[model samples]
Target: MGSLAFFIASLGFLLPLVSNANPLDKRAAALKPFNLRVTFKPAAYAVPSTIQHVQDAVACGASNGVTVTAKSGGHSYGSHGLGGEDGHLIIDMRNFSNVTVDQTAQTANIGPGGRLGNVATALYNQGKQAISHGTCPGVGVGGLTLHGGYGLSSRGRGLTLDNVLEATVVLANSTVVTASTTQNPDLFWALRGAGAAFGVVTNFKFKTFTAPENNIVFQYFFSPSSASQLATALTALQDFTRNSQPPELNMRLFLSSFTTFSGVYYGSRSDFDKIMNPLLSKMGIGSGTVSTNSWLNTLTSFSNGPLAQTGTYDTHETFFSKSLMPEYMSPEAITALSNYWNANARSNSRQWYLLFDCHGGNGSAITKVSADSTSYAHRNATFKMQFYDRVASGNYDPSWMPFLNGWVKSITDAMPSVNFGMYINYADTSLTKDEAHTHYWKDNYKKLVDVKMQYDPKRVFEGPQIVGS
Candidate 1:
């Protein structure tokens, strides 16, 4: 969901299976693997239609000393669903892709395999309701919700995890259990944000909200001729986010060939223009595009629809992405980022760009909740920064990677006072283990570890940077 770009890569060798059925059976091949760019092939892949099948896969993996990795949409940036290495069994949950809505209860039961697009469409058809999810429709609800889903409606509606009322999970021991506010409360709290390490979530029961009838999307492309202009624009953006914060307004900044300011206002176009006028005028944006559309259409516009179905889905291309949750946008940080972009403008791949997502505000329900109430700890963050780049030929270029790494380090080092943290969903394998734990979990790391020990003391669900690993 960070940035949709296709990649071509080779697959790893498959290991023999213990099942009586042939490993190459039609069912096995029919199991859809979403991230083709990930070469971390498991010893076997199973499309489990029922809980029994999931249990059997776990049993097989346990008996053979191979770990079991649950692959829902397979959209994990770090390929956490693909074992993150090799010699594991993959439990593909595509068969479990189902969405059931209870109109009276104002709730929806979504399977882990269900993508955001399908979930949105299903809920919309049910009663014109919706949930907060990422921009990319192909991203699995399991992964997205488990790691704190951010989207166009997040600031107003809260995260996807915040909407989850309950979850059905298959623990490391292959036992099924339900976690919720009153049932397995500790696990419920842990699963909301740091779930990947404890168990495989099979289904999520979410509290739904009435979908907004129309959303106004505004797009502005600025060609700043000087650093002074860029700095002013950045300062205006910061001011707008901090002072004129509107719950309905979701703003994003992109730095590439040109500086682009995009925003989605969950209201009428006239109201959006009224709220954004001061920022627009201050930034000297004479003209821009504003269109009103349905919530589902807005999601499609953001992600380009289902990536798996689209030929543009880069199955072979691999990419590396890193994220930072900056407390606020500082002028020095802005200048440092601009300089980095200018220096690497021509050298970096066209697909590569920087993303700054406006996050917290007074109206934001995200900040209303206590940071310790859920596994997600970045409630005070004003914005999130992402540095994304595509890997050439499924591999990192030695010379280029070092430079890129140093550039990232410089950006973080430049802002020592900023409460910098990282989003686990936008995972970066290049980080050291300690760095990953500190950035991703923060103060929640110890509690998550304790829960991991309780559910999986033997560490069955394991991966790089996974809790208790």
Candidate 2:
């Protein structure tokens, strides 16, 4: 039997067959909410073990006139998985995880509850295959794909949404439907990028690729003892982004107590060296490390070393993140970032960092997909930058949040010469509805609104900064 069929067949043996009694009412006290950042207590929480369970939960919520929020990986930076308000029903999709790969077809049917780590490991075990996904392993495949997932392989392979062949979604009226290129084409287009506003996705059919034999990971740490050194490094980075970037290369810049340039080159070591040596020489970076490893190990290194989220899907950490897409990075913008970091180096009560993720290359598949093809409107962006702050749940002080927000604003305000748009995945609850619409959707906002009107006219699945909200 297929994996989904087996799961349904075994559900009777795994869970007790309950009648019309609500599962949420039976398991409410034992429920552990995913995010600690959001203080709202849900009216009830349902952990669906099967598709039927999901349908029942939706029907129950609809009957009671309570909003339903679906929690897949539970890693929403703004805690949008929790509905951003009190007294809503939350559908926890963790139990529904099951991955089945068809080697001949080079495709995998991934359950909504599957994490990137589980999916990667499964595909690797089957036939040394893999899918493009975010750095963190604990993030849900459903949520990531819904927000147009990007990662190290994105430039060459394309975003996660680009790989999706089909999706089984439970609509607002509790009707299950399959969305793909031929069936429900308009809904498929909207679901690729702005799916959260439409319905709950139960399964994703994704096109997979053969994993690369070897991968190169490199990192350069620059303390910049003097202003000249810092300027040289920053300028070299800007030049590299503008002039010499390979489609196989994915680069990221970090500005915290110091500046670090890190990236993965999905190719042989010699090829990576050929592309990176000149940039290193120009920037005067002599002490960085570059290592080559198998594809799985490379993903492991990124997760354990850079991402720092080593736990399973249930792992929860309190964090706040805001993102912006800048057309280009000017020297003045670099200076502004340095000044902000230096000014607040000691005043920060929690760990904080800035990330500059280089996006497009000359042959980037990300840019090959037209801007109007999907709701992800920032296809032409040079870099997507994020301001991140990590705080313990108990140590989270509301006063400190404003300082972090203000610092990000100051840095963004400094770059008047560039146009800025925000990433929808790194959602910011502070943005007004109009601001969110303009920044996240940009030119595609009107089309997304029309789709929302057609599919979810009543707005059953609503969260902060959601498409129709």
Candidate 3:
């Protein structure tokens, strides 16, 4: 019999004391949330894999009084921090990354620890594709949808979480169970946005959307880009959304010294005219070109294939929408944006990118599922904010960390949104309490904490970036 079987057989005796039970002590358990060091190691716990065998290592870790921190590709910017910066019971989840697509059902069971490239290719084998953040192929969907994944297709499909139907979670006690509306509904509601906070998700079942046999898309570059003009362009695209437009079109505005507009529509060469004609004529931009290619080809263009032979990189993101709530930006708010970007990216290294993923495909799709239905509370809002800054450690000069530290200080000094809640997945581990509480949706945090206490009262499941971690 499995461990789950054993757990079920003994439930009668364990039921009375489940919640009030003491958590394995942080000092004695041989593992803790995070202690913070540059090169994080699991000081007391770590487990490797062979093919797909994580059980032995997990057992070994358990026998030694350590909890396993499962890792897929370890793609997160600060994923290593989970082991208290050195408590090493990391479980690599990549070997189990195989994806299977059921075309008739238009559903996919993707390994939580698997990268999308692997999953997407597997789905292609069966003639299907999911509404996912397809921009970065290596990002784990586990982490992506857990924090509401956004992508090139988001403008038409809504964030990836909207399309999810189920998730298989490995709870604190190491029991694997399925979460969906029909079963363990509270956990289902919690998994949408708070998956990282709830537990380790083993796999996710997503409702797949049909992929075009051919795709028509284009990328336009702008000159003399000013922030005001960029903002205008972006807000205008939001206005362009409607019931028509093939429901397959996605538009997103890019910013920087340059502005790039990218769109993907599922139609023939002729459809490009109907799509671009409106935006170009309305925006009044003089020179931009359009190209047609297969959907896969266009996706390749977005990901920007393999880098130099020797490649190792880290990514960090923050999302704040001064666009919504309170209807304005205070001086402090602007100061925060400017300081964070300058400190984390432009002037410093190891941070790069600012991405805004508008909830598309009728954001109402997610709203239909109750506010308390999922940990994702911003469903009522039309779009999710994204900020990306890509920088490599080797690129920074002497005082980079100082600048970053100062930048973070400046941003926190200002107030931005009604929802102090920042997206859990994109936030820096050190985010202030207010930011976490309101950045996503107000009044949602306390409820999340309640859910936290209910599921893992002892808090055996550790989360560094989430509240009460």
Candidate 4:
């Protein structure tokens, strides 16, 4: 999610996101810190958005072993996960958005805080490809990769972290070092899933693959008022996962108000018809439109379409998730979501939404990455159910948030085991600290805390993960 053009421009500039405007805009003289976005607001809030001569700053912090946490981009719902609690210093990693490819190694070194756009372009330059969820160009790579990335490239390849070969982190001791399978094996194992808790990751080394020579994929949309239609699509993908068929076949079962059945096949047009042509008849879908796209197409174009292509803006968000398998979303979930969105659609004043992080693409690749290895633990799931309702945020209205949130909770309660873990990045402050830990990352949460205690023994890298502050 590296916003390249903008990041490059911010080299000698300051762009603050919070109010009261206190980022130590003026350069630090001795005690003044560089590469650190500090807001000594009601309390000390640190953001790790850049890595400029980090080793020096880290060393300076290490004198007192500088207590600092890291924030990539403000994408995490959990108060920007790395925003340390209780007057803590921070290293904003958002400014480290540089992606470059190594033609020799056939890989790319992407900044932890960079977005997918820059990373993809870097690889594209080297004529290499990396699997990443490119849904939004603005999503920072930190939280996205830290949470087991799944996106348009998922079905063809696998999760984003799967392709990661190495990472450079700034340890609590203010030491910068690299971690990979060959180096720091234990830390490497922990990093794959439990990365955020370890330290401030500066750059990520991703193994690349050959970009599609010229691939064709179709995106099918439906406004079905019921579940049977959505289920038919979900079950079909489940079948694909159960049987690892041709390498060319990849299917995604997306569940927003406008459920999308998007798939990518390596083959050309003829190859698409051979497989998908049958789905049109099998699914019994009507009132739906279809469109095929190429690499030139934009994601916003694929998502929401004209109906919602305009996209809704969010002042702030509180994301929630409960275990929801394909079975859950089908028939019942679809109906619920349809009614939910329709209600919101009718309201001219409200902007409520439900974004489905469609989870599928077989299990082996992800399951292979041990469940305990990282903070992400939803291995058994085909899709991670997500709720994205825009609440009245500006004026701090408590009116609709609680009600819509409650309704989503009821639907989630129907299927608990399916409730895997809530995403730390999509966290909502409304949820209790325990709730955020248990719902999103589960056992991995404890492991992360342990890692925090070990690396940042002083509790310097605290974020929303800490309970009761």
lDDT of each: 0.74, 0.75, 0.54, 0.54
Q: Which candidate is the best by lDDT?
A: 2
| Model 2 regions more than 4 Å off | 1-35, 226-232, 305-314, 346-349, 416-419
Rank ordering of all candidates by lDDT, starting from the highest: 2, 1, 4, 3
Give candidate 3 regions above 4 Å deviation. 1-38, 44-68, 80-84, 129-131, 225-228, 238-247, 268-272, 281-284, 306-353, 360-370, 380-383, 392-417, 440-442
> Estimated TM-score per prediction?
0.88, 0.88, 0.72, 0.74
- Total clashing residue pairs per candidate? 7, 0, 38, 33
Model 2 agreement with the true structure over 174-293: per-residue lDDT tens digits: 899999989887788889878888888999999999998668888888666654566677678766765577788987888666668888898888888888889888877777888887
Predicted structure 4, TM vs. truth: 0.74
Candidate 2 local Cα displacement, residue 338, angstroms: 2.6
Ranking by TM-score: 1, 2, 4, 3
**Residues 285-354, model 4: lDDT tens digits:** 4444445554434344443322121121122333322233342344455455445445543342544444
**Stretches of model 1 off by over 4 angstroms after superposition:** 1-38, 306-316, 346-349, 391-398, 417-419
TM-score of 3: 0.72
lDDT of 1 by residue, 101-137 (tens): 8988889999988877877888888988889888887
Model 3 lDDT tens row, 1-469: 2443233224322122222434343222222221112235453332222322343444444545554466554544445324324554565454456578888899988877666665666666677565556577766667777767766666556667878889877665556678898988777877777666666666788888776557777777654234344444544444554222345666555644355666676666676786677776565455666677765666676776631111222333221212231222344554465545543444333443444444432432443456665677665544444444333323323233344345434544575233433455554434454555555445566777887787666555454445346
Q: Which residue ranges in model 4 land beyond 4 Å of their true spot?
A: 1-67, 81-86, 226-259, 278-283, 287-349, 361-364, 367-375, 391-396, 416-419, 466-469
